[model samples]
Target: MVVLATKLYVEGDARERSLDSLRSLVDNELGELDVEFELGVRHDDFPSVTIEGEDATVARNVLREEFGEIVPDLESGETYAGTLESWDEDGIVLDAGQDKGVRISTDELGLGQGSAIQIRERYGLVQHMPLRFVYGGDGDPSRLAEEEQDRLYDWTRGDGRLNVNSATRAEVRATLNRAGHAQDYVTVERIGLLEQSVICTEDTDPPGLLASVGEYLPAELRCVVP
Candidate 1:
């Protein structure tokens, strides 16, 4: 069984829809393989997949590559994926499937900012968004992964974006289409199963787009103004 790094924190009908969507996504990823799988959510909200059959090994790897995995142990100097849990003046805490949350200090963040909250705002990082970090065990300091920093930095170099959490890609797309702003965004990039980034067109304003669709989303929305 491979536990997915992303979270399914929504409740009731939303949770069911998200699960169904995830099931379809998993099928799309592993349908070609000769494997049978079952999906379940852990107590921590991470989804797990149990696979069996001739291509189970390949399917497991495919799932791990596609949706990062939550492992049982952390080794020194190794990179791992974790969901953004909380942040403060000190740093950000990531739920890395451990008894205690992993904390990456602000200085180690290397994003060049004021406080951890300020950094999160600038990068448009939503709660529960999956982030990659390098583990520094044995009293060493952990830091955000270089590739992850690059990706967040690249967000500022673009046409601007509105990052959102607690909504699926399909739901975000539908909200934009229903709000008559379908042409405003370049695309909705999936940051995680429920976290999405709406890339604005050159002519669109990130905050304006957020204002137009915020009421319809029922989720947290933050804009990255370039």
Candidate 2:
């Protein structure tokens, strides 16, 4: 069994749809190998799959490559996907299913020039955002991937938008409607199982939209400015 780093935190019909989507995605990825598998979401929302049949080993490798692997423990010089759980004067804490939270020091951020809180604000690093990080033993060395950094940077250069975490696409859309801000965004893009990017209209302000509809949606909403 291999657990995927992606999460599915949506409930009700959205949760079912997300699960079905994951099931289909797994089937499509592993079907070519003729492997039998069972896919399900864990209590914490992480997806896991159990492979059977002769090609199980090969299938497992493919899944690991496509979806980041979830390990039982942290290892030095290894990369893992974790969710941003919280932040403090020390730094940011990532939850990767370990008994203790993994800490990413401010120096390791590599964002150049700023405290952890300032860096997070400049990059809109909302809680529960999925991030890829490499752990280096003592001296507290850990770093986010260059690709992840580039992606976050791009968001800052894009048109006014709101990136959301811990909600499904449908829920986000519904929240916008309920808050009377449905016309503010052009569309909702699903970045991960529970992560979404709300593309704001040309005249809409990302931060304003977040402030208006944020309370209605039980998720983290951050502004993206061009």
Candidate 3:
């Protein structure tokens, strides 16, 4: 398995509105390229990215162009990370790490499904240290796992009320564990005669979301009314 660092340094408002979409696209395309690209920023706020693949150099080149198009002034480089495994068209699957998987989209990439990446940069491009994430390989099994993970986290307490009718009790507990059960992630209260207390948290917004629970769990997974 190869993991490459891919960065985006653009002059647009991507850092604000398009960061998530851009990062997600990078993750997905890297998978198509048979590699793993991790998006991030350096301490100096330069846009930087890391990638891994058997055809490491080719993957780096593709991302360099892709990042450049996002931010024309992109500068790219690479430092070989050790190899892990190799697979066919689907590529190798990582255990649990930033390079585990990537996201792909035509609207996001703006080039096509699996557009050729063109930009590159190990660091010195964005405005902050690299901050990004991904979950699994490709195909049905990986997609199901990622989808379930999302559903669990979507359940939350908020809007001056708590809810969770569609969510199973087990799902609620899973989100707590995924977020580390930190105080900031969940707020609890005794309700009527229910055995379990209601849980609530504020949306941390972008960047440090992993640190904050969030303004509310996603609306679809409300705590009170279904």
RMSD of each: 0.7, 3.2, 18.6
Q: Candidate 2: give the clashing pairs.
A: none
- Tell me the lDDT of candidate 2: 0.80
Off by over 4 Å in 3: 1-18, 69-226
lDDT for model 3 comes to 0.32
On TM-score, the leading prediction is 1
**Superposed Cα deviation of residue 223, candidate 3 (Å):** 45
lDDT of 1 at 155: 96
- Per residue, candidate 3 scores C-alpha lDDT tens digits across 6-32 of 222333453443346456655655666
TM-score of 1: 0.98
Cα deviation at 149, candidate 2, in Å, is: 1.5
Model 2 ranges off by over 4 Å = 8-18, 24-33, 43-45, 53-58, 138-140, 174-187
Q: Sort by TM-score, best first.
A: 1, 2, 3
Q: For each candidate, give its TM-score against the true structure.
A: 0.98, 0.79, 0.24
Q: List, residue by residue over 26-124, the lDDT tens digit for candidate 1.
A: 999998999999999999999999999999999999988988999999999999999999999989999999999999999989899699999999999
Model 1 off-target regions past 4 Å? Answer: none
